[model samples]
Target: MSSLIEGYNYDIFISYCQKDNKHDGWVTEFVDNLKGELESTFKEEISVYFDINPHDGLLETHDVDESLKEKLKCLVFIPIISRTYCDQRSFAWEHEFIAFVEQASKDQFGLKVKLPNGNVAGRVLPVRIYDLDDNDVRLYESVLDTVLRGIEFIYREPGVNRPLKPDDDEKINLNRTKYRNQINKTANAVRDVITALEHYDHEPVTVAKDIFKPASIPSETGKTKIVTGSLILLALIVLGFFLLPKLLKSEGEPEKTIAVLLFQNYSGDPSQEYMCNGLTNEIIGHLYKIKSFDRVVPIDYVLPYRGTDKKPSRIADELKVNYILSGNFNTTRDTVRITAHLIDPRKDKILWQNGFDQPYKRIITIPADIATQIADCLKTNLTALEKQNIERIPTTNLEAYQLIQQTKNQFNTRTYESLNQLYDLSLKAIDLDPGYADAYAGAGSMLILTGTTFQHTAMQTVIEDALKLWRKALELDQNNASAHCGLALYNDWIIWDYIRAEEEFLKAIELSPNNQSFMKGYSEFLQKRNRLEDARAYKVKAEDDPIRIDILSLVLSGEKDEAHKYLNTYLQSKKIFAGEYFIWLEDYEAAKSICEAALQKKSQSMLAPRYQACLALAYYKTNDHHKAQMIIDQLIEKSDISLAGSPEFYTGWYYSGIGKIDSAFYWLEKAYKNRCPEIPWLKVDPGFKNIRSDDRYWDLYERAGHKAYDDYRAGLKRRKSNR
Candidate 1:
């Protein structure tokens, strides 16, 4: 039978290994049930092609049947992916699976199509019956160019990895998925794919209602006048036919995903390159505010391509983005000249290009204007609030604006000196313009970072400085999202007040819902609170130490194997993560070796007190009290004031190791009063394990604003039923 959308042989083609059906006809049963579900789903007749007796046609590619090629030209190809289904030598894998992908990709609808409901689906739909190995999943994802997501049909258990049976007890299954629901989901997905294919070429109809209108000529018109009017009407129809589909696909939300790279400095001046980066960030910031742009890739993804001569298409291919917005910026005296090109990097073709020549004083307006133009060209509808935020000018004083931009550029360098430079620059920016909320917020965040990360200032001083600065920023601009985030971090790390932290987080989210970094912070905060399930629901991009964060999550959930695997990825570049996780796992000897190796290289102050403290703690744990004391003495000689949860916090660990319970609690309480960053990890931190049984520990744990220690541990045990 021909396909429902025409130019096709069948509506659905079921491809599988013949061995799959030999196991009590699992493949056959699934196909039968899918067909039954499709009948109720579609008002139109659904045609399905299923071969009961399949031949393993492993001959040359040319020997494959021409009729099978036509048969593979279906709307949806449901591959029954079993343990042996994806083998390279298999007939179905080569002839049906790969063949259909090549054929559909060249067809009118393409291999992947956007559904009417706005989700993208591939022509190859896998009904996976076996949990796939990582290599196999990667192989499939390479071809699909997306994560391997599909309807899972496997019944999982401690040792079982097989096809789910129709009569299987779902309550006992690890997957907790019924066999019938899988079939229904498959049918619905097939319907979505086919329905989208049917209407793919006719999307212009949805928008043509507004563009194409009938024209009425006067009854007494002259012949030339009537002809002219009719020609104008014909021209309008032609324009709608030619332009509307390209403009209004997905109802003004095109399926193009994009990243705006740092614009190049056309002035041939290195100093001006920062200006280009500032513009890039401004454009990206504006794009993020546009709610219709659901797939705007973050600037972090494009940072590696900053000074490279790589083609936009090549960059897009590596970034897994289809669109690349790249440009060049030049300012000559009073005028700023900027050129931008929105390119479909897959085809290496420029979809849109424009240049702006405006006064350098008005340079702040260009990024927003360019963003809106690109959005318009892509047919993405924008909210009024989004437009306002993008267009709103910050500080009419251009020097202060430029200082703020320069201040923002320092952190991207990631130098040890960048934090101090960032703080100084932000302070200068605020001095120039007292009303600059972002600068104030940046200054406040830097205080916390420099104080905790590098011990440049006292913890108490950092908290006081940050709160005042952050509060002043918010007072200046109530809509400032940066100030809100700074306040959230203050409450999260310094105060350990979960309620206020969450309130600030929610406020920041309300102001900037598309700010993924905020969501990522909130996700970590939720995980810290042990709301594991809730934390998993928000998938956001992390800014720094992403693998460490992942390892932290895995370790908390008692997935030591997974945590170690992630930690190994950061072994060379960031050994601190491995050392930290090792200590948590009680592998002090390994931690000692790593910290020692790390200390042997570079300046003593490079990662001061961090590896030193870790190394000292490792020594104490291994019963080498003398080596521990020596390192502790070195840290003590360097500073009378402790930084982060360190030095004094380190002293507390050494005391705890030596069974000095009173001394340990004393230093710990001091760290707690200063709101040590490590206080929030009270329940899981192995540092205080020796003193945890003491009454003072529970009082301190609860005082640090966490749930009661005993109750919290009970909750953890309840939530995690031995994984």
Candidate 2:
């Protein structure tokens, strides 16, 4: 009978006693509503098995239906537990629940699967319409050896408990909401289990112990208890040895990768370019809420594709994605028309396409609808929570959303005035809509970027303001990934709370794992702690992002040559990186040449002093102390007024390179106090290794919140010995 069905015969099997169905037909109505919701939730047709005929008992001589036995191979076994259902030991309990339980016991019975919250949950889901008695709970929990958790449908009034009906909520107005919530929960749970099962890689599960077979008639009550107890004991042993370990590992598969291409401007008016760009950016943001995607190429990365004559497959290869989403937008007098197409680049096929032509006021709905449609076409298993997150529009105010999108477009312009202007725009967005979460997140990011702007406020005051803005953003939308990422940066750099910063970064990644900003921050955080291998893994996870490729993990891992090769191949302006690498390799001539070339290219750039300092370091290494000293003196005078934080850090570098240990420590401490951005590179930057033998160097390292893996291992060893 089990062999009759392939992967899954039914999406869900609803088991209930006939008496519940007779009681105002609650079961029938519930099934009907569930079917309707299933249709709306799933792209494919959902097959649900609900036996309507009342068969109170199954006699020993009564022939069992082969079709019923075949239908038991369902993805989800939703036992509609009620007082009558729990008390009976007939077809509901025997053939429906126990039969499937026995079959699963022979498979990976207790292997925990990943949940939407990055946790794990079991497979057997229950829908409770009546309170479970002690016996009812024992029978189920014994076989599973876990709590009998379910989506409970019993409504508790002041002193009464009753099954929730679809139309019974006149006073509280919560019955319908509760029912819908449970349905959604059940549907999403089934999806989670199926996804985990499809992706899980592990040893085969088998029952080594004796298998108990039921007689022609069901087992006697005492015998049933013994059988169930033995199964529970064996399950405990299996779980202790197997399932517990698998819970810590993730299920693996080909990652769901996507790239959002630049939206074409069909709006004839070139002055409305901002609107078209904003719409494209907003669509990307909405798509980011779909946690199923492993990568979503950010707007900046895909901007080059706007006018290029590249094929979808070629662009997909460049972006390293399985799918590409491109669209066109036209803004008319009172309406906007947006068309979206999702292409499978491997086959150069259009998998899904849709268009929305709506009034300007209703424009906010377009992104959500487009994201949902793409997910449906890709067959992405979105949980109810993820679906709600994807559908949530940031704000109803078009001006607020438009302003925030414009800020995203201009965020890369990291000038003092440009960033301050972006901050002002964010404030304007918030004024238009006080509850806009993205506006607050945008404002916080701009404040963080323009931290050195003396035109507005001090760095400390800017940090505090940015922190508050991010907090407000989280208050408005707790699941805002950008808000979490901004807070992660604040905690890491300003507050120096390494543990809290890591937690925030991880939370942001969990909310939107494909976001490059979160991935880069996490990589830098791991690097700061001197976890080079761990940092490298995160760097590779975000390798599609050009900015993230400049991490120091490769050089720190003693692969400086590999780093140099990558820079030589990938970066067009590789002189600065090559100079850094040559300094690490002790090739003074090569380092000096690279630095001189970089300075010649941009003698007036903000980083010119840093290049000059590097050249001086190379000069000192090559036994040219006279030239090195002259250049260092010129830099110390010329960079005295530079607003950029590089002057302090490079001054320390020049001193350190010339073997002036005390002077190096003084300038390094000054840079640390000044909150130079280069402080994060202290652990991996080879220049700092010169003074590692000094106590002051260790003190500075500790102040920078650095730690090694050996430190953690030593702590573990101490705890173990104490125990």
Q: How many residue pairs clash in each candidate?
A: 0, 0
Please report, as a residue range, the 10-residue window in candidate 1 with the lowest summed lDDT: 212-221
lDDT of 1 by residue, 395-420 (tens): 77788888778866666645336577
Model 2 deviation from native, Cα RMSD in Å:
16.0
**TM-scores of all models?**
0.59, 0.62
Give a tens-digit lDDT track for model 2, residues 140-220: 665665545577676643224578876555234212225666667667766776666656655443222212222211122
Segments in model 2 whose C-alpha atoms lie over 4 Å from true places: 1-255, 308-310, 345-348, 412-417, 451-461, 544-574, 603-609, 634-643, 707-723
List the candidate 1 regions with Cα displacement exceeding 4 Å.
1-256, 268-270, 295-301, 414-418, 514-516, 532-540, 543-550, 553-574, 603-607, 635-639, 642-645, 657-660, 708-723
**Of the candidates shown, which would achieve the greatest TM-score relative to the real structure?**
2
Q: Give Cα distance to truth, residue 239, candidate 1, Å.
A: 38
- Output the worst ten-in-a-row residue range by lDDT, candidate 2: 209-218
Q: What is the lDDT of residue 168 in candidate 1?
A: 90
